[model samples]
Target: MKTLKSRPSAILFSCRARRGVLARGLNTTREIAMPEYLSPGVYVEEVDAGTQRIPGISTSIDRARWQSLVAEFKKTVVPQAPAWTDSNDTDPGVTLLELFAWLTENLLYRAHDIPERGRNAALRAATALSVLGHRCTTECATLTRAHFFAGQLLDAATLQAEQDYHREKLRRHNRMLHGFGIVSGLGVHVEATSDPGGGRVIVDPGYAIDRCGEEIAVCTGATLAFPSVGNEAFVSLRFWEHPCPPDSPSASGEPDVTRVEEACVIGFAQAVSPPALALARLIRADGGWRVDPAFVPPRAGAVMA
Candidate 1:
């Protein structure tokens, strides 16, 4: 099926020690044992969306526009779509405003050039996809915020319309994609990632489906594989971590371990310093993702939960 709405997935929560300090023997020891790093610093491991910084004013404007988009979307768009589908719906339960807000935040305010202007064409060209998962802190602050938001800047109507347009497009084309696996030449905008062994993806409207043999792989908020079961396809998912930030250097000249978890530290090949573990955790949380600490950087700093 076409990519579905992102739902809650593997997530790590940041819970502070009630006392904030471990006593001599740490009397009240109760291992709640949530998904966490067996590393030095107390951290929660997760997969999350990446964030891009903009000017202060620009951020303010972007937030304002997002508010407007949500309002308009709740009024105009959301009313039309259902939350989900038995097979998948022509309309979505998520709002155009929400999608646009993400695009504004993550897409860095990029717009599509009417690649095909229709559902069929858009799907053929879209190799990547996204989904909407939740760990919504619902808090205004970005701290401990796990969600989908990573990209550049955006303008007024241009950004909203662009997001709105794709969201609607995703709604329109989802059913078709769910039925047939990958479709090339169908024009849809996706962010091509430099990840090895991952599909070249595009994220707008929150999802995309790629055909891999008998499996119809889905990409949106997370990556999943669906085995085509007769006329229908059953989905299996795999998530990817957002890339390490460009500016922040994690590896030292000789390769200093960034954020060490219970597992690995250096990329077997790159050794060029990946994202700091702290940063990686934040990104994963943004997407409400799951992490296998084995693949993460080795632990460093303080003991985590």
Candidate 2:
């Protein structure tokens, strides 16, 4: 019997052979023959193709782990500094720890994903506003139109009805789809009241859009009166549009009517629905009314006051 000298390659070969045996036991019929190592320096053993490779662990810190790490740090500090007992948010040490933790959390998030500038660059020139504008223009262009044949008789009523329909469609397009709001100059100001105990305010002339997409113009401004019933009252501008026909018939014997009849009503209370815009909040104290400094006027199409 000849004795074989032990080497590192021989030990590796024995381990691989044992692994192949175990693999064969687990429903694998493939046979693996150990390579003879006559001259040994370094030998490479191929891993089993059927075996699943273990994935590397992620170094990214998640929200839960970050919070745990902050908590652990806080706990560790108590043992090192027994004199430091205050752990409230008002404490300088705790505030600094929380600030540092927040910064670290943000840094970790940025490290794990593409930068914001890179993502924005990927979008090129397209934006939310541009996409919406294109969609509105396309929809308006593709709107259905009534077709008239050569022999079809045209009447004033029919023409007027068609015109009104298209006008309404255009109005809706501009109001709902295109976007409507006060373009500029709708400022509410406190004014002097004739009655000593009454509160009065005046709205500056401005152009705005109503909830129904109708354009409203404050040509000469409007006055709002706040009653002394409550300590606080919200002032709002209300709009009403209705069809107003002329009292006399037109020259063609048809009714001359204005479809877009605009009216502005200043109310002491907040408006509950559309076609309205909140102007200001009034606070009454010592029999005098003043505009609340904290009141913020919301834009059109926003939540109703």
Query: For every candidate structure, what is the RMSD over all alpha carbons to the true structure, in angstroms?
Result: 24.4, 36.8
lDDT, model 2, position 82: 57
By summed lDDT, the worst window of 10 consecutive residues in model 2 runs over 18-27
lDDT (0-100) at residue 158 of candidate 2?
A: 72
What TM-score fits each model?
0.18, 0.43
Could you give candidate 1's per-residue lDDT for residues 126-202 as a string of tens digits?
Answer: 11221111011112232221223568455555555665455445433443334222222212222323343122222
lDDT tens digits, residue span 1-305, model 2: 01111111111112212111001111111111223332232121212323332132111222332333334444455566756756477778888988997997698578976354543332222212212221212133434555689899988767877875686685676565546556566687776656553545666767666555556566555443444366776665544332233457669876555342444444455323444566677787776878888977755554333
The best candidate by TM-score is 2
Q: Give the TM-score of candidate 1.
A: 0.18
Measured on C-alpha atoms, candidate 1 has an lDDT of: 0.24
- Looking at model 1, residue 217 earns an lDDT score of 18
lDDT top scorer: 2
